[model samples]
Target: MERIAVSALRKTFTLKPGQTVTVDGVTSDRIAVLDGVDLTIDSGEFITVVGPSGSGKSVLLDVIAGLTEATSGVARIDGIEVSKPQTRTAYVFQQYALFPWRTALQNVEYALEVRGVATAERRDKARHFLHLFGLKGFEDRFPSQLSGGMQQRVAIARALSTDPQVLLMDEPFAALDAQTRDILQSELLRIWEQIKTTVVFVTHSIDEAIYLADRVVVMTARPASIKEIVAIDLPRPRDLDIRNSAAFNAYRGRVWESLRDEVGKAQRDWALASSYAN
Candidate 1:
């Protein structure tokens, strides 16, 4: 079953008067981030998106999350148009975004609270997820007291507390140290296997993209569109050591090969735009 569908999706940002940007030596008052993107995501499938900097990968996620609107197309969840955030969808952003005053348990409970879950039930649910994320002892620790990795765990726990059918994560681990990132990656896969929510995760790291995806969606540079959708053939219960396996490297190489040109083009465009700004 298709849980999310995007068709002819184009997101444009029109600058206010006197504002402009240079792209490939051309100046424009409007920027097209997503251009005619078409995709179908199956229920409970994990999809990872990768692209060059400024390729609108995050924008695509925002559109699907209904945090942003498309300029000329449609994004749908369960065949219903996505014009606003859906109750069945949850988003985890790159930033931990945990309320500073809230304890880890409180942060996780916030989602359920918003939905009006009874206090006793929400508390139990939050504790369960916190334990699942290995934050049992730290449940009362405020975001200020937790380590970066632990903070992120709370963020992920909060997103999942709602039992959302679709989870949209935009580089949720990007800010962590590499070792922490790797740990969280494995932890995420472990939890995901048990819950099986449909996921759309955006990442700049090719390795992370491949490690977490059922399919990797590579987007072109600015004015982004699908470059290729590469299916991951690796077996499940994947360990971090799989990163060294020849099969894993083969998948990485394929994704990089498709993405290399786009990376170069995005860089060149950035250079050109920078020169124009000078």
Candidate 2:
């Protein structure tokens, strides 16, 4: 059942000879963002990761996506080690990353085109996903012509159009207003329910993590490792209404408890580094 596996993962970024960073008043020549991290994700699972800023949540996603290689250990999908971008995975970054020149439909079709899907079929597939994401009538619009939320929706549609077995998202809604984020969250759940694709989403919002994740992966401070894996037993096909429920609050409380110390440490480290910089 494990579709993704990461074992004893360690990544160290060695600075140039003269480069140094001070953390907690200690100067360091190397930065360890992920150290001894081990995790397993099942197929068709929706997993969300939450940690303080700079806790390497994004790095973990990058490693799995094969955008960054580990200094040690390995990450694998379906038992194959991840070394480079693979067809089975699609990544949606914080930025829309849509080609400004490409219309919504064209943007969606681009992935299919790269995979060698024929013109007519890719167009049909792109149109269908855009429609499903509530951008049916706006497929002709360019990314510049659309609202921030609309552009992100197009990005999501494009990612899904490829029918990837694994979807990796890095704070995909971090820049959006609350109302837009709420809308997209529900829409994403709708799409996920229909298609049941495996998703690994990284976010800092506890509320968003609880709402979207079937299980939440909490990571430690820099040199990240799994701190906790909390499972949500809530019924599926969820909506925003669940946000107000006692069970929801309970989950939020639990996750926050695990996260508070990490956040404090990160803030302290930042303050220390700032003082050193000054």
Candidate 3:
């Protein structure tokens, strides 16, 4: 079954003096940054969206998460049109977005608190998730007390605590060091394998996309549209070794080759905008 269905999705923002549609029109914008985009995802599928910065990768994730309202078009989760934020869908942002003052367990419990889950029950559930992330001993640690990767683990635990059916992540690993990011990527895959939730992940890293997703959705520069959707049929339980494989490099090359033009366009746009700002 389709977990997400987007149709004629369009989003526009008018700068104070200029009215512009950042995304014009397309069939699916599930990973399209511009207006009028359309796309669909089946249940339990892991899909990664990759493109140069400003290609609207993050915007597309936001649209699916209902964080950004589309000027026109439809984004539906489980066949219901998404008009507002729904708990069935969860978003894990790049910043980790955790409370520095809260302990890791408390951070995960926050969502349950808002949902009014009883104290005892929420604590039990939060503990389960924290332990699943190898954070059992650090449940009492605050965000400031943990490393970058640990903090992101807590963030993931908190997002999963709600038992969301669809997970929308925006560059959740971009802030970590290379080794840390690699570790978390494996952990994320383990969790996904167990939970089998539908995931829409956004990133600019080619290797990351190749490492994690079952399919990679490549997008164009601003007014972003789906340039191509390439399948990564690599065998799972994938690890660092997969990165050195011929199959991995072959797929990586295809994704990069398809994105080369869009990356150039984004760079040109940045240059022009920088000149105008000065």
Candidate 4:
């Protein structure tokens, strides 16, 4: 179990090289992406974040992962400020960044290798994770030889093999088909139950958020900030059959109600900007 606290988190991005603006003789070429996010996640919680595309959901995850510096405020993991990438955290991205040359087993073993785990122990750990993720027979398969879902599973196994206290996932199933996405979502929950590791997952689907999370964090349009936090009161060991339940639809509706205006605003903003450009 690991605790996470993001206090007044802010992030701004510089658009271009030497593109400066003057404000009281201060020149800058920056725009705010995330703004003043404040949230706390308890240990072993399954949390999902939802927002419009480009609303800084991924940026927020990166900040918490210690891969990106905040422009203001703080992100802490277990009370320690995240200033840089730490061994206590692992990230799984949508792209499934696996080593093309390495087999699934080898790729999972790589994380342990970097942590200085001995070859035998790491191999055993990697095999266990691969088996847990239901990739038992495909251990030697390369990334190209496996399906997109399998590759992402390997990526997840790689992350979990390190036994990190916190796992940060940025839409890891976004690339898969509808069926694959549904299956992976179930697999993820199963793994979460077994591992009991704190997880911060970002997704665009309202149903997915409500289904997978104990609490869903909804962000406003960019410059993003926490617009609302919705707690899921559903029971554990949930199955896909619950998606058709009235309670499930109610959760989905609640999240959508909170997110509708923000998503519309984001769309309008993009349209306005495009109109200006054209």
Candidate 5:
């Protein structure tokens, strides 16, 4: 079954002086952020998007999440066109975006609370996910008290607490240090393995994309489109040792080569944008 269907998505942002089409003339921006991106994601698929900064990777994800509108295109979840945010999708952002006043458990329960889950049931479900994320003891801790990775874990648990059919993550691991990022990545994989949610993940790190995705969708620069959908062909429950394997390097090299020109173009575009702003 198709979990996400995107066709001919083009998005433009109107600036004060001009319009910047972040995604232009692209068909299928919904296939997990690829260049020339016409792709379909099957239900329960774990797909990662790897591109240089400003390659419209996040824009693609936002379109799928319905956070941003596509200027011209179609994004559907479960065969229904998504014109706005749907309850079936949940997004975990890089910044952990938790309520500062809420404790970890309370934060996790926030979504359920909003959905009007009964107090007892919501607390129970929230506690379960918190425990699932290894956040059992930290339930009482505020975001200020937790480390960066822990906060992200809480964010993930919170997103999952809503029982979303599809998970959209925008570089959730980027803010953490190397060791913490590795640990959370491993933990996230474990959670995904158990949950079987269709995941569309965005990241700039080749290693992370290679490690986590069944397929890596590499994208081009501005007005970005899918360049290639590199199947990892690597076995699941991926371990750090895989990063050293020849297969890992092979995939990483392919992504870099595919994105080489796009990276340059994106950098130049940024410089141009800065110049225009000034």
Candidate 6:
């Protein structure tokens, strides 16, 4: 079933006078970051979005999450137009975004607390998710006491504790070391298999995008639109070793090929804008 739908979506930002920004090969008083973008994400689907910097990949996620409104078109969740944050949706960003004073368990319970869940029930749910994310013994530790990976794990645990119908992640693991990132990737896949929640993850890494997605959505440069949607046919229960497989490499190449020109274009646009600023 189509759990989320975006149709002819357009988002424009009006720049202050003398604040010049270039988008879609044009420099103007207003810029359209997302232009006529359309996409449909099914229930329980894992979709990864990839594109060059400033290509509105994050904007698309924001629109779908109801953090930003479209200047035109609409984004719908379960057939209802999304104008504000949906109760059944959860968002996890690159930052841990956990309270420094809160313990791991308390951080996870925050979401449930906001929803008015009973104190005892919320505590149990938080503990279950934290343990599932491998933070079992660290439950009492504050964010400052944990490593970067542990912090992110707690963030993910908190997001999942709500048992969200849709999970919107914006490079949630981007800050971790390569090794830690790999470990969390495997762990995430394992957890996803059991809960099967709909996920829309945005990342800059082609490998990460391909590895985590059922289909990878590649967007064009500024005035971003869907350039391509690459289906990942690789088997699930995927391990880190699969990255070394020939098929995985092939998929990587295809995604990079589609993204290469857009990246170049984005860079060129940035350079041009800088020159003009000077």
lDDT: worst 10-residue window of model 1 = 19-28
Which regions of candidate 1 fall more than 4 Å away from where they truly are? 23-26
TM-score of candidate 6 versus the correct structure, residues matched by position:
0.96
Better of 1 and 2 by lDDT: 1
User: After superposing candidate 4, which stretches have Cα over 4 Å from the reference?
Assistant: 18-28
Per-residue lDDT tens digits for candidate 5, residues 5-70, read 888877765554443333345433232333335669999999999877977888888889988877
RMSD in Å for all candidates: 1.1, 1.2, 4.0, 2.5, 4.3, 1.5
Q: Candidate 2 or 3, higher lDDT?
A: 2
lDDT of 2 at 74: 99
Query: Please, what is the whole-model Cα lDDT of each candidate in the order they appear?
Result: 0.94, 0.93, 0.87, 0.92, 0.86, 0.93
Can you write out model 1's per-residue Cα lDDT over 81-174, one digit (the tens) per residue? 9999888999998988999999999999999999999999999999999999999799889999998999999999999999999999999999
In angstroms, give how far residue 233 of model 4 lies from its true place. Answer: 0.6
Q: Considering only N, C-alpha and C atoms within 3 Å, which residue pairs clash in candidate 2?
A: none
Q: Compared with the true structure, what per-residue lDDT tens digits does model 2 show for residues 149-226?
A: 999999999999888999999999998999999999999999999899999999999999999999999999886899
Candidate 4, residue 55: lDDT: 99
Residue pairs that clash (backbone atoms under 3 angstroms), model 6: none
Task: Flag the better candidate by lDDT, 4 or 5.
Answer: 4
- Worst lDDT run of 10 residues, candidate 5, spans 27-36
- TM-score for each model: 0.97, 0.97, 0.93, 0.95, 0.91, 0.96
* Winning model by TM-score: 1
